[model samples]
Target: MIDKFVPSVATALAGVKDGATILVGGFGAVGQPDLLIEGLIEQGAGDLTVVANNAGYGRVGLARLLAAGRVRRLVCSYPRIPGSVIFEDLYRAGRLELELVPQGTLAERLRAAGAGIPAFFTPTGAGTRLVDGKETRRIGTRDYVLEHALHGDVALIEAWQADRWGNLTYRGSSRNFNPVMATAAELTIAQVYHAAPLGALDPEAIVTPGIYVDRIVHHPAGALHA
Candidate 1:
């Protein structure tokens, strides 16, 4: 078996380069990989396109990345949050780009990428600006817009526990986007609160299988907000 564990966050994210598309798994701060975000901030690679559920709220997680001016574009469902002043200012000034996707569509796009399906049709954005210039097909009585799959160069995700083989188990709402994002990236790195020995995790409890994950970094206890 391949040992997917990495010594540190920096090591886990070592090869990340500028202008790379990154998938950040989180719903606000719930499933955000804090330590990995910190490492990326320290890595200082700029001009990033980030995909997530929402723009981060405060000075944590994706917020920190945005504040550092490393992100060039944001591809997410909800870009506005209570304290997302950084994103608001940059966006208003045209310094940042935004691709607003509907929540369910975003999830399905990532899932489609992981499943190797290039594009899929959905009625979610038919007849709206979201479907502008995109192909639309009439199915039954409704029109469906073609939405392309979303894939990333790197995926930073957080999990409750992981085995040495990189099998992951999430806690509560933290499971939101982490699992799907794991499968949709070229390099998937997971930050976990606990690291169990191989085979310690129950097979049925694994939300993300080790095959999709490339690396695992054990985050310090209490790093996650719970």
Candidate 2:
């Protein structure tokens, strides 16, 4: 069990290298893994490519990474925020790189990676500015553009409860991105407010199976407010 539960975030991220793509699981501030994010900031991991639902909520989410200049590229839905430091500003100022993908399509890409399907066709962004230079193939009578699956070197996930075996349970909105991201990366690092032994979590309550997780880190402080 000691091998499965890493005490510190730095050790959990020891194998992660610079310029690696990373999938960050969160819907907003609610499910954002603040502890792990703070650890990454202190770790000084730079030139990162982040895949998440949003840039961040105020300063707790991706914004913290941005402030630290650790992230170089971002693949997300929303680009700008009113009076907030966003990924676009960093990109526009030649400090960051960005690829804005449609939210649904982005989720599908990660799912495809976890499912081991290399590339799939979708009509999500057809005949629009998004399809400007992409390859288009026709299936039967309809046109579908191919989007490749997205996989990352590391996936950062947050959970409401996690067992020592790495089984994870997310509460409410936090559940949105944790389960999918668990399978979307080569190494999954989870942050939980409550960490217990292997059998402590009810089977039905587990959102992410332990098999998909590689490390579990507990914050103990419980959920954090934005």
Candidate 3:
């Protein structure tokens, strides 16, 4: 029954409920899954807590969600530029809830979760604001801060190519977060421009195996950048 690949982002996210935590795989503009984001907006799934590297730029990426007011909180590692639509509005109204993580630690936390580790220690922000109120321990006179794993109900990712069975290959920086997020989410939805049959993609090229992906959404054509 799961043999055929889904064709739309909305269909892929049909099972996601409101208020779900989501790990969105993207580092800035490159790795984002646009179709799924658009579909989530259209579906009006609200009160979401989203985890991503950036909130997207302009109207082309995660900014769309901010514009739609669908997401309630964002956990990311970057600062938004002043006067940007979403950033400015959120700042002026104090409506946005943000949790800033150290860039490397954020990625590692997600990776650790996917690998089944509950937590890990990092020295990335030992005495900085990023470690405020966080637990710390000293190992051999050096303080290491604790960072917990991050998992989600669903993860939205974009890949360059995928198979009917969900094997995925990402292009460029899209490779960064998609693979890790795929494993950390209970359900992972991928939007790929091409969908090959299962086993068609060489084993070596399968960055994310089919087992991690719950649904494959095929979007053969669209303006990915605008």
Give the Cα lDDT of each candidate: 0.92, 0.81, 0.83
Give the runs in model 1 whose Cα sits over 4 Å from its true position: 223-226
Q: What lDDT tens digits, residue by residue, belong to model 2 across residues 1-226?
A: 2346786788877877789888888877767777788877777778999998878746666787887888888888766754346555677799877788898899989999999999889988888888788889888988898999999999998888887777888788778877888899999998888877768898998888888999887777634421
Evaluate residue 115 in candidate 3 and report its C-alpha lDDT on the 0 to 100 scale: 98
The prediction achieving the highest lDDT against the true structure is 1
- Each candidate's TM vs. the true structure? 0.96, 0.91, 0.93
Model 1 C-alpha lDDT per residue in residues 1-100, reported as the tens digit of each score: 5788888788999999999999999898898988899899998899999999998987788888998999999999989989988789889999889999
- In the predicted model 1, the residue pairs found to clash are none
Question: Cα lDDT of model 1 overall?
Answer: 0.92
In every candidate, how many clashes are there?
0, 0, 0
Off by over 4 Å in 3: 1-4, 81-84, 223-226
**lDDT at position 164, candidate 1:** 80
Ranking by lDDT: 1, 3, 2
TM-score of 2: 0.91
Summarize candidate 3's per-residue lDDT along 139-186 as a digit string, tens digits: 887999989999999999989998877889988777988898999999
Candidate 1 at 86: error in angstroms? Answer: 1.2
